[model samples]
Target: MLNSRFDMKDMDLAHVILGIKISRTSNRLTLDQSHYVDKILEKFSNDDTSLARTPIDTSKHLLKNRGEAVSQVEYSRVIESLMYLMSCTRPEIAFVVNKVCQFMQKPLNSHWKKKKRILGYLNGTVNYGLHFTPTHLYNLTWLVTRMRTGHLIVMMRRSTTGIACFWVQILSLGNQRNKRYTVSRSSTEAEYRSVASLVAEITWIRGLLQEIHVHSSKPPIIWCDNSSTVRLTSNPVLHARTKHIELDLYFVREKVQQKN
Candidate 1:
């Protein structure tokens, strides 16, 4: 953005391109820098770090340490850099990033090793940006003709610290998922839970998109492979099994019903 304005020495884009990721849609874009985290792994961690199945292992408990101390400076710098990414477009790393940052003031070798494990994860999914194009989004494969190109752009923050955020603007650019399962559960439970997990994210891009819409009359389109879930949401006749599910999962159903 610097070169076009007047004169800031057109430094090639390569320097700023810190081996992160870029996923694009007709209307928006997403940026992530997990690759640099991997580089940190190669530089500081072991090759055999166990891969975590999920970003945050809820079963794991981290206790406060009042043990032997290690140097805090390097730990601080690395943690700070990771925080910048976490606050911005790479919230997937927030758990690990925050965990690592916690040790910055009085770090330990063990804590440092944990930080390296995160880097190794970056080594694998270097370009895993979730490009959400109007065309790319198909909640259910049934509605294609209704799709239109949207106007959107994802501008992310780059303060090197603080919250990293995606400033998604929906102007007008665009004219603008699949799952198979054998389950006899309520349609709402199946579909809602199938959306991975909600706890991992603070706010979703869909929410951001809805915020930008010119009209609030229509609900966002959701396509589900499970017809039962659709039925559950549209017509809520709860049974024994579905009653066990959390009530918060109905947010989408409630909004959809209100025709939001």
Candidate 2:
């Protein structure tokens, strides 16, 4: 189609684009940035650094730094590198990476150690990548995790092949910051906001699919661990208790009514 309009040439095949390497098989296509991962590790990590099995320690709490900054510029550089990797192929470390990002301006020694731990984790799994396979079936699912102070939204899709793919495109970029600048009064309110955000993104994706002549036989499904949030969505009455989050609540209810 493009040949009939503007001037263009065929590159034939692509193995790498913007540091991401693509590999293909008969039934699947995979993307990884092993070279980029190695570069990041070598630039910021030492040769004798021990490998870490996980990106961050779950038991440890990362508090705001109150002392002097330790290599602030270098710390920002490392975060940028990891952010790119996290944006591209690595979704497992999204939570930890974003958690450390909160302290980028004045990172302390503890924050630097956390950054090194991420590098060590990467060193252990440099070959991890995203995989996609051919399939006729498509379903969209959103999983929202509500926390006391914040929330994590993960969108996933499954193909007929039964292989689940984590969709982190939004999280890697748009979701780094919260849509609502203020805090919600309750966890249910937070869940509703998250669900509304996911529905908005899914609507955009479904439009893109339609533009490309692709269609799904069913509407997207959202899987939330919170029962109250689910009940609120289907509940026809909006109580005065949820008046604070009425906007988000109405947005979600409207989408649900549309069978989205």
Question: Candidate 1, residues 62-142: lDDT per residue as tens digits?
Answer: 343634666788778767766765554455676456556655667877676666666556656555443443433312111
Candidate 2 lDDT score relative to the true structure = 0.73
Q: How much is the lDDT of residue 257 in candidate 2?
A: 92
Global fold similarity of model 2 (TM-score)? 0.85
Candidate 1 global TM-score: 0.42
lDDT of 1 at 154: 8
Q: Whole-model Cα lDDT per candidate?
A: 0.46, 0.73
How much lDDT does candidate 1 score? Answer: 0.46
TM-score of each: 0.42, 0.85
* Index of the highest-TM-score prediction: 2
Model 1 clashing-pair count: 20
Candidate 2 residue spans exceeding 4 A from truth: 1-6, 66-68, 149-180
Give the range of the ten consecutive residues with the poorest summed lDDT in model 1.
145-154
